[model samples]
Target: MLSQPNYREIKSSYLITKEAIELAKLQDIDTKKYKELLKSALEQVLDALGISFDEIRGIKKMDAFF
Candidate 1:
C-alpha cells in the first residue's frame, strides 16, 4: 500500500511531466515525436511503480494515476 506522502509524490511527479510536455508543445515540439518520447518515459515510470497498463483499468482508485 502506498502511503499518503508517496501518493502525493507520484502525483506531483506526474504534474511535472504534464507541465514539461505542455512547455515543449508551447515551444513547438512535434506531437508525434513528443508522444513517442512520452510513451517511453511513461513505460519506465509505470514499470518502476509496478503498475501495468492492464491493471490500471482494474484498479478504480488508480485509474487516474496513469
Candidate 2:
C-alpha cells in the first residue's frame, strides 16, 4: 500500500499534468493522444495504489479536471 505522502505526491503530480494537458489542448497541441496516454498512466498508478478516481475527485479541496 502506498503511504499518504506518496499518494499525495502522485495525486498532485497527476493534477498538474492534467492542467498542462488542458493548456496544451487550448494551444491546439494535439492533446487527444496525450490525454489518452495520461489517463492510462494515471489509472494504472491509482490501481496500484488502491485508490479510486471517485475518491480523488471527491476531495473537497481540489478541483480535479477528470
Candidate 3:
C-alpha cells in the first residue's frame, strides 16, 4: 500500500498534469497525442498505487469533459 505522503504526491502530480492540459488547450496547442499519453500514464500510476479514479477530486473521469 502507498503511504499517505506518497499518495498526496501522486495526487499533486495528477492535478499538475490536469492544469498543464488546460493550459495547453488555452494556448491552442494540439494536445491530442500528449493528452492520451498523460492519461495512460496517470491510469497506470493510479493502478500501481491501488487508487481509483474516484479517489481524486476536482477532476473528471479520465478528463473526458476536458
Candidate 4:
C-alpha cells in the first residue's frame, strides 16, 4: 500500500497506521516518543515520495551529509 500511487488509498493507509500507533501508545505497548516520531516521519516521507513523481523534472546533485 505504501508504494501505491492512489492518493486516497495512501491517506487512508497513513491514517490507519497512525491510529494503530496511537492506540498502542494508549495501551503502553510502545511509549517512546522518538519511536513514534520516527514512524510518523517515515509515513510522511512515503506520502511525499508517492506524490512527487508527477512534479519531478530533473536530477538533483548528490552531496554527502556531514
TM-score of each: 0.34, 0.36, 0.34, 0.25
Model 3 worst lDDT run, 10 consecutive residues: 9-18
User: Which pairs clash inside model 4?
Assistant: none
Pairs clashing within candidate 1? none
The residue-by-residue lDDT of candidate 4 on 1-61, one tens digit each, is 5565664452433333355543555565465886767666666666767733223324343
lDDT of each: 0.64, 0.66, 0.64, 0.52
lDDT of 4: 0.52
RMSD of 3: 18.5
Error of 2 at 66 (Å): 22
Clash count per candidate: 0, 0, 0, 0
Q: Name model 2 segments beyond 4 Å from true.
A: 1-28, 54-66
Query: Across residues 3-66, which tens digit of lDDT does each residue of candidate 1 receive?
Result: 6764654334333334454355555657799777877777788999988744654645565678
Best-fitting candidate, measured by TM-score? Answer: 2
lDDT of 2: 0.66
Model 3, residue 8: what's the lDDT?
Answer: 48
The candidates, ranked best first by TM-score, are 2, 3, 1, 4
